[model samples]
Target chain A: QIAVANAQELLQRMTDKCFRKCIGKPGGSLDNSEQKCIAMCMDRYMDAWNTVSRAYNSRLQRERANM
Target chain B: MDPSASGMGSVDPRLRHFIEVETQKQRFQQLVHQMTELCWEKCVDKPGPKLDSRAEACLVNCVERFIDTSRFIVKRLEQTQKSKAGFSESLSD
Candidate 1:
């Protein structure tokens, strides 16, 4: 359940973000270039998420070790 | 009637622990989502073919500095609150 919720949260954020990045104007339809941009944006967003997660986990571990 | 034990008898200790762990994990995941959105704005100008090295470094630094900023604000607030409390007490006396 937690995993499902997490995925849903990621999906929502990704949709919002990619929409902002890819769509400059309210086009009648998602153009081919816009679709491509959204695909790339989704991948980059996941990469960014994993990078942030690793950084935070390491920071937590470092703090724990200090304590 | 002991209020603390009113509804505690039926829950298994292991189940409670599992829930606690799950809650903690969820909190971490939620923060990751927030920070990713924030740092994405700061680091990424445009989504490229891949996440470039420069953008990745920026994201890592953004996460670290963001945490530092949070800690600094918390500590500063505590200090100010403590001083405010002392000032109020002195004024009362």
Candidate 2:
């Protein structure tokens, strides 16, 4: 249940971010180029999330070891 | 009324520990979401075929610098608070 909620939150943020990045100006409908941009944005967002997570985790570990 | 029997003390220690760990994990996930949004803007110009090496490096540095900024703010605030307390103490004396 916790995992599900976490995933949902991630999905919500990703959608928000991708929409902002891909849609410069909302057209009549979702254009092919916009769709492609969103797809790429989603992938990059996930990659960024993973990178931040790893960075934070290692920092915590280093701080703990220092303590 | 026995407080231990009525409240959190009644829960098993292992369960309590599990809850604490889960809460910590949730906080970690929350921060990751926030940092991703922040760093995405700073590091990512446009979504590309992949996260290029330069963008990847920027994200990593962004995370490090963000944490450093947080720590610096906290330390600065503590220093100010300490000085304020000392100022008040001296005034009182």
Candidate 3:
């Protein structure tokens, strides 16, 4: 589906941006340790994303109730 | 940012559907970017083999409070604007 491709592109961009943040400079190829770092980085990034998402969702819910 | 491009049904259905999906996708990406930047500062120290539970919790709280703050500001502004309509109107003009 077109949706999947768009999602993939966004994921790719996020990976690039976050990797750069988590990894300062590229070493010769991705060494074993670096690969592990990236994997964890990806997981943590997703965790952070979900956290913010849930937070925002709840905030919206509370605000709606107030209104 | 422009909604005019997606206005009305003049394009192919498939393309229109694609546009709708892409718009949603972009919104997700934008939020993810914002959240990443925020939680990076709050949760991340030196990159490690795995993300510790403490940092993970911080990330969740960060996101929730960020949204809460945004809502709080919006509501506060609306309330203030009611009494300061002339002030905002002058700025808008």
Candidate 4:
């Protein structure tokens, strides 16, 4: 249940972000280049998310060790 | 839900632990989402064929610095509260 909710939320956020990043003007339709940009943006967004998560988890582990 | 089964004691301890761990992980993921959106703006000029090395480094540093800033704020607040408590105690005495 929680996993489903997280996935849905991630998708929603990705759509919002990718739209802003890729679409300069909301024209009649999503052009081919815009579609391509959104695709790449989604991948990079996931990469960034994982990178941040790893960095944060390592920091948490370091703090736990200190305590 | 029955009144007889109102408390968490009714739940399996293992399941409870699983929920707790998942909740912690979700919190981390949620923060990552937020920070990624924020740092994406600051670091990324354009989405390229891949996440560039510089942008990747920026995202990592952004996460670390954000955590540090939060900890610093919390510590500063605790110090302020301690000093205020002392002042209030002196006034009451």
Instruction: Please give the clash total of every predicted structure, in order.
Output: 0, 0, 2, 0
- Chain A of candidate 1 scores what in TM-score? 0.93
**Candidate with maximal TM-score:** 1
* lDDT (Cα, tens digit) per residue for candidate 2, span B22-71: 98999988888899889999999888899999999999999999999999
Colliding residue pairs in candidate 3? A52-B63, A55-B64
- Candidate 1 — which residues are off by over 4 angstroms? B1-10, B86-93
Candidate 2 TM-score restricted to chain A? 0.90
Tens digit of lDDT per residue, candidate 3, span B2-39? 58765644788898888788887677657766776667
Every model: Cα RMSD to truth = 4.4, 4.7, 4.9, 5.3
lDDT per residue for candidate 1 within B1-93, as digits (tens), equals: 877566656889998789789989999999999999999999998989999999999999999999999999999978987867885567669
DockQ score, prediction 1? 0.93
lDDT of 1 by residue, A1-67 (tens): 9999999999999999999889999778998998999999999999999999999999989989999
Task: State, as a TM-score between 0 and 1, how close model 3 is to the true structure.
Answer: 0.61
- Which residue pairs collide, candidate 1? none
RMSD (Cα, Å) of candidate 1?
4.4
lDDT of 3 by residue, A1-67 (tens): 6457646754785588567765667777777766777787777666666666666666657767999
- Provide the lDDT at B12 for model 2: 91
lDDT score, candidate 4: 0.85
Off by over 4 Å in 4: B1-11, B85-93
**lDDT against the true structure, each candidate:** 0.93, 0.90, 0.71, 0.85
Q: Please rank every candidate by TM-score, starting with the best.
A: 1, 2, 4, 3
Error of 1 at A21 (Å): 1.1
After superposition, candidate 3 runs with Cα above 4 Å error: A1-13, A58-67, B1-29
